[model samples]
Target chain A: MRYAFFPGCSLETTAWDFDRSVRAVCRTLGITLEDIPDWVCCGSTPAHTSNASLAVALPVMTLQKAKHMGCPVMTACASCYSRLRTANHKVCSDPDERQRAERVTGKPYDGSVEVRHVVDVLVNDFGLDNIRARVKRSLSGVRVASYYGCLLTRPPEIVAFDNPEHPSCMDDLFKAAGAEAVEWPYRTECCGAGLSMTEPDAVNRLGHKLVSMARQAGADCIAVACPLCQLNLDLRQADAAKAYGAVLPTPVLYVTQLLGLALGLSVGELGFNALTVSADSVLQRCEMVVSAGRGGRP
Target chain B: MENRLESTGTSFLDEVQRRSGTPISACFQCHKCSTGCPIGPEMDVLSSQIMRLIHLGEEKEVLESQGIWMCASCEACSTRCPMGIDIAGVMDTLRMMAVERKVAPPDARAKHFAHSFLQSVRHHGRVYEMGMLVAYKFRSRDFFTDMDKGPKMLMKKKLAFLPIRSGAASEVKEVFKRVEEEKEQ
Candidate 1:
């Protein structure tokens, strides 16, 4: 299967590991991703939080470029997916805005191009059953908390992908890879997304709550689909502990990283070491690594 | 932290409606938005109270309160609201209005960060994390805040030194120009 990929700005910088693991996992699954030519930033939280028109225009520009690829546009970052989808919705739903945006974008965006998250592509487009067929060394006995920290599913009408209240796509994805997804609340809670650095105190408090909830539920590692979520849970975990007074070595991992490991991809290939909390001890306990002579199935 | 509740010449509700396109009259004070909000406790005015303030045309109070900045825009309130009011979107509208009116200071660095981030994207087509954060420090005048995060993220190779500009610089510029024109209208 071939598709156009729009790795937003975060992927190139802070979430570089997410970008790497996404490519590595797709290579194993035989999914070819073509880079959208002249692709720009998705406008992120800055655009919407400041000006409405810029938010609509920035993503529309990229989505317009993705249309040339004539396939689904996949995004690794949840914030990018939300921005792109919001732009698509605005132009499709309003004729006046569409006419105005057409003048700016130089194309009619009837919202034809499908903007999707990578996890959605894996579970629905690629089929979880098909993905399960490729797992050679499964992550048996490893308990994972599927963390969906807003954007992939919110303001249901705009995103229209998963259940807003309680999402299960990530859970099914982890289970297919042979890891038991522990049921936990606060999966869709806010993680102080754009304020991680600016307002460190509030973010640390929020992160502390999320980590404490996950640890209380007995998750060995936290799996997320969004870059900001992974950063707050993994990188700022120490600050969260210091603020909220719970110290657990709960690792935060990207969903693809966990799935890639189960698919027999090496730790390095999946960017496992990028995580602040170490996954070595947990993976060792689960006996996930195959011998040096044997690799995952091709 | 009280703002002088003054009568405005322009309709405050109309101003919010013009910016966000969310109907303030639809909110029936269900308080569901407040109950579902994760950061409601941290907020000084809470979500439902902000909606009421908007209705009452307490423009200064609505903009000055930490509630709007505290909102993470998780859409939890937007999704759970019985009347289908986009409380989160309204929060965005309030934040932008606050910034436009130059009311945000000290408490809402998130607003300043967004402005700096937009400046970086307008220049480079994507975010240079180190560059954007540095510029935000200068703009917000909080240079020491979150400075410790630098060395660690740099060591992890999370902060790229240089930004890669693609072929869409002119197009992005045109888009920003149009947005500004739209705001004027």
Candidate 2:
């Protein structure tokens, strides 16, 4: 499978581990992801809230470039996926918006480029059967709470991928990887995406609820698809726990990282050292960590 | 709490309906939107109340309300809405209108965060996290925000020391410029 990859900004910095695991896992699966050259920010939440036209224009500019690549645009960041898909929807359905976009960018373009998230590519294109065959290490004992968060599945008409209310793609992937996918109610809960820096209290409150519930559901760790979600749930996990008086840490792993571990990739390869809440206990539970060493490299 | 419909005779509900293109009029005040809102507790005005306020033509209340700024834009409300009104989309439109009209947003930090984020995109084509965070801190003047975690993140090599400048930065700037020009026109 070949795709024009738009890793988005968060992958470059805060969520580099997610980017690393995504690339490693895709490489193993024989999926070719060609980075869309010169892809800019998708104008995430800020643009959408500040100016509607700029939000549409930014993604349209990138989609216009991806259209020439002769492949679907793939992104791991849920925010990027939502923005791109929303832009495509508007550009195709609304003539006035399309005209304005063309007039602004000075490029005549139809929103024909298809956008897919990494999870969508894995679950649908690769097929769970094919992925199951590739799993070298079975995550039998490790219970995973697959946290979809908001962007990947919501605004159903725009995203149009997976069930918006109760998405099972990530859970399906977990089962394929031989991990026990725990049932959790907060799968599609908001992690307070952009509010992390502005109103962290809200982020903490929401994050705390997610972590507490995941624990209640018997999950050793939380798996996420969005960088912002990972950052909020993992980075601020301690603060969230402290604020809400929930018992200690819950490791947050990217869906790619979880799959990477099941694919027999080492902790070093998946960049597990970067995770704030250590995934050591979970790794040990899955028997991915034989030795009681710090770095759980196989 | 008494808000008389302005004699200025502009229908705030009509304006929102036009801009968002969502059937705001179809909302029957079921409060489903507010009920599903993840950040509803933090909101000064409930999502359903905002819709009601708009229906009542309380433009100033809806624009200046903390609820619009506090919306996580999760679309939970939009997803579960029985009337098919894009509640999240309406929130987006209201936020843009508030910014455009300089409605003295209740949350200054939210305003600064949005500005800081967009400013980073305009300059670097993509977000330079450290630069954007610093700018946001300085502007919002909340210096101690997440200060404790900075060292740990840096130590883990999670924080990029310098910006990863995008290849087509100038083209990105052009996109921003064109959008701004169109908006002005």
Candidate 3:
């Protein structure tokens, strides 16, 4: 299967690992991700509060571009997926909004292209059996907390791909990849996005609580779909530890990265080195860490 | 009590409504938010009390309250509110207002961190951790708090001394510009 990929802005920088792993996983699954050229930022947090029109227009342009490319658009970032899907839903459901969006993009968007989160494509399109068949090494000993964050599930009508309250998409993806999915509260807690900068204490305290909850649930690592969440949970963890005088070294991984590893992709290909916490110890425990680093491009 | 009341011009209710957009008057004093708050035990005041202060137009008290700083913006109040008020948004608005007024909590470290985060985002169109940490340490003069932590982070290869700028950084700048204009208006 082939689809246009939207990596969004954060993936290119802080979450480069996600970008690399997603492409590697897609190649392993025989899927081609034709990146939409010159794709802009998805306007994740800022757009929602700044102006509704800008938010809709930003993603509408991408969708229009995907339609122009004649392929369905797939997004790995949950915030990007949510924003694009929200824009897509608004355009499809509201005619006046759609017309306004078309005017902004200078192209009539008939809502022809489908905006899909990577989890939806993996679970619904690729199917669990197919993913299971490709897993060379099972993550049997690895206990993971599948954190779905707010954007992927909330405002359900716009991104109605999974259960808003208790999403199973990540759980199912981890299971298919041969990892144990742990149950934890705060799976949907806010990682305090840009607010982390304006309010680090609050973000640190909250982040610490979320990480602690996941660890308390016996998770060796936390898997997420949003780059912001990964940054807060994994990168800011040391600061969080100091606030509470605790040590939390739990690694955070994008769902695709874990899937790529389970599919036997090399660590370098998945950009493991870019992660804030090294996955070698955890992956080694499961005997799934690849010895060689043959950088493969999708 | 009269002197205290006269000292603050606006009441908490009016200040809260003005800042939070949550109708303090709509609250029936139900403690659902307080009851459901995961961090309630850690807070100086219950969420319900904060809502009540807003309704009462006790603006000075609400704005100066430690509760504003303690709020995690977890949306637990919003989730549990039968009144459908966005308690978290109210907290966020109050926090923003606090920052604007320079009435942030007395923690210099926290204040420096907040400033560092905004500077990083404003400059790079995204958060740059290394840049933010360096800025925070330099600004706050708390150089050694995390001095030992950095080497450990580096050992784990988690510390990237460089900031990676986004490819579509200009677009991000435009978004920020638009947001600033809206805020000004």
Q: Whole-model Cα lDDT per candidate? A: 0.83, 0.89, 0.72
Angstrom error of the Cα, residue B18, model 3: value is 13
Q: Every model's DockQ, to 2 decimals?
A: 0.71, 0.82, 0.14
Instruction: Please state what fraction of the native interface contacts candidate 2 reproduces.
Output: 0.87
**Chain A TM-score, each candidate:** 0.95, 0.97, 0.94
- Tens digit per residue, CA lDDT, model 2, A1-298: 9999999999988888888899999998999999999898999999998888888888988898899999999999999999999999999999998998898778987999999999999999999999999999999998999999999998899997799989999999999999999998999999999898989999999999999999999999999999999999998998988889866588999999999989988887887988999888889888865443335223
On DockQ, the candidate that comes out on top is 2
Residue lDDT tens for model 3, B1-185: 45433426375555656655566567888798888665566567677897777665565666666676655444547755778777766775666666666776655244456566545655665556678778987887767654655675555444567765555446546644654565466
Candidate with better TM-score, 2 vs 3: 2
TM-score of chain B, candidates 1 onward in order: 0.87, 0.92, 0.77
Candidate 3 lands at a TM-score of 0.72
Docking outcome class, model 1: medium
The global Cα lDDT (0 to 1) of model 2 is 0.89
A1-298: candidate 3 lDDT, tens digit per residue: 8899988766665667788888888888998999887576665554443344566777776676678788789999877887788788878887977886776555688776888888889999999999999899788888999998777776465577887667898899889887899988778777765545445566677788888999899998999888878877887898899887585688888898888878887777887776777677667767853465734332
Off by over 4 Å in 2: A290-298, B1-9
lDDT of 3: 0.72
What class would a CAPRI assessor give candidate 2's docking?
Answer: high
Ten contiguous residues with the weakest lDDT in model 3 chain B: B1-10
Residue B7 C-alpha lDDT in model 1: 33
True contacts kept of 3: 0.07
